[model samples]
Target: MSAMNAPLDLPLHAATLNPFIAQAWRERITPALVDYIAIPAKSPMFDADWQAHGLIDRVVRDAATWVESRKVPGLTLEVLRLESRTPVLFFEVEATQSVPTGAQAPTILIYGHLDKQPEFSGWRADLGPWTPKIDAGKLYGRGGADDGYAIYAAVSAIEAVKAQGALHPRIVGLIETCEESGSFDLPIYLEALRPRLGEVSLVVCLDSGAGNYDQLWLTTSLRGNVTGTLKVEVLTEGVHSGDGSGLVPSSFRVLRQVLDRLEDARSGHLLPGAFHCEIPVERIDQAKVAAQALGESVWKNYPWACGADGGLTLPVSDDPVELLLNRTWRPTLSITGVDGIPPLAQAGNVLRPFTAFKLSLRLPPLIEGHEAAVKLKTLLEDNAPYNARVTFEPDGRVGAWGASGWNAPTLAPWLERAMDAASRQHFGAPLGYIGQGGTIPLMNLLQQGFPQAQMMVCGVLGPKSNAHGPNEFLHLDYAERLTASVAQVIAAHP
Candidate 1:
């Protein structure tokens, strides 16, 4: 398990290490990685009772200890407090080798979060969500894949390169714990460490995914997200359903009618002016390639209710490109949850007096966050059918970001080559580029700060990885291979 073993004499480039080093790295890391996956650092959003749970502090201290023990050549490890109450463990690993003279190499930055989504109990067989269990080549645990292993993977990759005396580029691992909750505290932490986060040229984020386990998915764009609560008051108090059936206007009905005005029920397209955006030509091309690779398995892989009409109600694009473009480059609205409504088991024969719903809006990268929010709120407020008292309050918002046109010429090829090498070594196929549906707000901010820096977003969450849902698991072999791929990217940077 030690990273200091004599470095293998393999060539540092992708073609040089392709078939052999990639497999060796996966075999070496698989066993010890399970222990790293067992920590339960559930996100603060779902684990509001985190302090009483005791896992948060344990996970942080464990990571700090791991970083300290490594003694990376010039790096300093310390657990510092940001904003007095927020505990942030900072690991500053300095560059080991001097840059070649006259070389315009920029200091590469790698970012990941240690926190994970909450895991509910009741898994099948003997599996418990918190207990790390490896079955059929998959690692089942809460934070194992979402991002817990990203920091370890990044450091391990660099260490492997260093062992070979092939380490030339400067890599800094910027690990955080609040990414799951909209990364609310990141800007503050970034400001506090402004002096130390110097001269960055490239940022590598292992927080996203590919469409499948076969290809290395590179994210070119991210959708912005806005979440808020909408409350509608229809009556002063609840009334008997039999008596109020026709007379009283139910809040649920009013809410549904208002939402219908904002979206087309059949096509799922946003109403005019809700938000404006253009789908990029590059994204459209990438989606088409991904769809062809996925095939019919795409629809069959979804874990939905049994006997559900698979293709009847579900809309399938004429081609894979359209499907991928709709998900990545377009705006979407969904009703996440409703409050003031009792479950079927607690059902009562009464018309509810008031109902509130949580709505989530995903905006295209071209739209501004605040502007989208304002447009959505205005649309909903104006369309209220029953003149119901409707109120919209912002819960959380993260702006969408378009990829900078500068770095792609250089960074994209490096990533594609690294991914192709890994995939050919592991699965005997070439890697591909794909667009993701989720948002990583910090990527846009970091890009803004260092306009000239190259950026690449890569990770291990593919279809059925179920990041924020029940039975979340990380494909063990895929993650290990991904770690090796990251190593290749760092070593191959020229």
Candidate 2:
């Protein structure tokens, strides 16, 4: 029978799903994940000498090696590379067209990334960023949670479908290695492989966030990013504070002055007109639905640091709905890193020569990130406070993306039913929808490329997963169910 009318005995049932993929994770993917996390495969932005370091190559090689060992019936996996750019592990899994209905199947594209964020500070003492530690069913390490499990998870889902004797479309997997670096090199590879990639009926992305671990989380939208460096220089060399305190201005003060033009100092609200946009009615309605499902956890689920006063509170409104809107529909700025600042232990009474800050700004779904970057540059450089040498250098920018999730008539209901079935079978709860505050540059590109294709963005990064922060982890049980859910959707696809 065709997949449309096939029995729902596709091995994703609670009885078979957990035991099958759980054992697979234990015997195969977990060990591989441990090794995957051991490598410091920091993105190109963090490791400027990424090619020389070879960590990115090592990750691609290891994952490719694992895929080769699978030896799927008609699988072809290769590390597709562009000149001087990071490699993308491409896998083409031929479809098994043996259903009784004998209907033609559609082509599917599954996208993921292998590159990882840099090791930020504050990991628990016993758990280092590269140290693979498994505790109480959670795997503690980098990349494994943020997305190192993707390739293995995708292949496992396909395998689950095959084992059930279910029919699925031809699978094209694009696992890039530069997603964490704003995906600058992705367009080149996408253009080159356009012919082979062809038109896709559906796109499955396993690189997004989850609202909670109890149920499947569908990412309905993703915020865009505009990141750059802001540098303020007051003097060519350091001078004793006593000598320069009155004679010259502190670079830190000048930096603050420049930032004031971008955002309100107290409220943390964006002040620039280019960064603001009216909230869409559809998104506002979805946010209310999501808020009801998420409830208090909308703010409570964050892994606040210890003793940050009962916990870190929101800089804006306390209402969960407003917080959700602030995160996804509003623009926000964060100074991720600073240079020319010495450790507190090495205190000096000298005025520093310059202060440079790495700024990461999240744009609303309707805002244009590149144009905002230009506006930001002009705002900071137009009037140099105290005639300081101030410069704003933008690294890269990508616009936010919103999917027609509820409006995907052909596949939305089918996937939702499959997702609900998988969730109830595994976790006893229904699937939920939430907007992701993070940025995924590829989603916008793919949505533009395949406007007719339905997109389902889901992942295992749930509460306190701390993707880019310290103590990152992956919930093993949730991942198993998630993989099964993916298989269920693939098997049920028309």
Candidate 3:
């Protein structure tokens, strides 16, 4: 059925909206999330056998079944698939309102992901990734907070808007299952759905982080990422360290030297100029505002280790603003994993022939991820010390290795007003803006696809939510409030 603008004689009040959304979450969404957390629906990258395991399909079907059961007034849902690619759930809700005659009905694209990161270690004794448990108000498990709850929250928001007689624009949902693997398959799916997606005017992405869970955090910028394996081989086989100690170059040492070219070992700054870009003044100013709001918590929120003397491992900088900028606007490298070193328990006195390190390079928002990746490979492999055989294989082809970062377009006046209003109503505080250190590849694509779209990039991964790590959880109260706020914002679309 075609949408027609309906008059909202009695606007939905916060008093009514908040309780209803909260109840929906408790009775309907929470149980489904428990089921979802138990699915072990790891992303395709982590579970190369995802198709054979059927976990991804199970979760998708489960979510679709739940949405269908809701029977949202005008929602139509489908599971879109391309052979040899992960499936995505596409759903749409007809508008309860329209624009001026002859103007295109503004489309709000709701985005989220169902796939989860791998089950990392360090889980509490009583908690596990696939084991769902509710402690305090947090639902503890993998993917619950990193946004396995997105589709459920989104549908609940739409339902609340319709139930309260609040008029909304045409809303569409695009939930993908490969987000954890950098969303490599998303381009094809987006291309296939382009005609049906219409001209998007806003994107409500629920795949980001919040500063305090006190209010909605509008993601201002996201750092890009390039991941690859850097390997350095010195000899064909291991030799006795005592015999080859001075005669041969250590592979690990060679690899370390190569890495030194990329980052300053002491200051932790990326050395390459091409990997960085000047921070936008607006973002820097926003960081100051966020710094005032967060204060020391900006660096204190992390789980730092205690030294032998009892002093906790501190961040690179003690200043809140620098800590925020270092993470959000600066390029940095993390050696996530390494190979060629035997466990100490093995007690081998052999000199390893090769060393491999998994390199994860985060770039500033304006730097191109693919270009940086190619340059990164050249930086490490060129002029190898001792002419050791060195190789760098990025996640993808040389041209496009990983996801690019996103700098949000200038906020539309209506959206800025609407967001503040929603946050104040639902959270009792005005909206907060912060730059997150994570990467959501879809944001870049959506911005390019809809240059004029207003982005409401917000999420429930607040301090200590621990996304993509053990003890990860979703704050129940916060999620419920966020859902209501999302509904309020959707209803306010001009």
Q: How many clashes does each candidate structure show, in the order listed?
A: 0, 0, 0
Give the top-scoring candidate (lDDT): 3
Instruction: Please provide, for model 3 over 50-109, each residue's C-alpha lDDT reduced to its tens digit, 9 standing for 90 to 100.
Output: 999999999999999999999999999999889999999999999886568787888999
| Model 1: worst 10 consecutive residues (lDDT sum) | 400-409
lDDT of 1 by residue, 353-372 (tens): 98999887877776666666
Overall lDDT per candidate, in order of appearance? 0.69, 0.82, 0.90
User: In model 2, what lDDT does residue 174 have?
Assistant: 95
TM-score of each: 0.86, 0.92, 0.96
Where model 3 places Cα greater than 4 Å from the true spot, the runs are 1-11, 98-102
Residue-level error in angstroms, candidate 3, position 73 = 0.8
lDDT for model 3 comes to: 0.90
lDDT of 2 by residue, 1-494 (tens): 32223234433455665677788898999999999999999999889999999999999999999989987777898898888999999988787774356554567889888899988999999998899999999999989987989999999888877777777878899999989888888888989988788668888999998888888777877788888889999989999998889789999999998999989989889997778778777677778887888888887876655565775755357787899889887888999989999999986999899999999888887666677677778899997989899998888533421111121113355666666666666676766777788888778778777787888888988888899999999999899888888888888777
Clashing pairs in 1: none
Give the Å shift of residue 319 in candidate 3. 0.6
Candidate 3 accuracy as TM-score: 0.96
Worst 10 residues of 3 by lDDT: 1-10
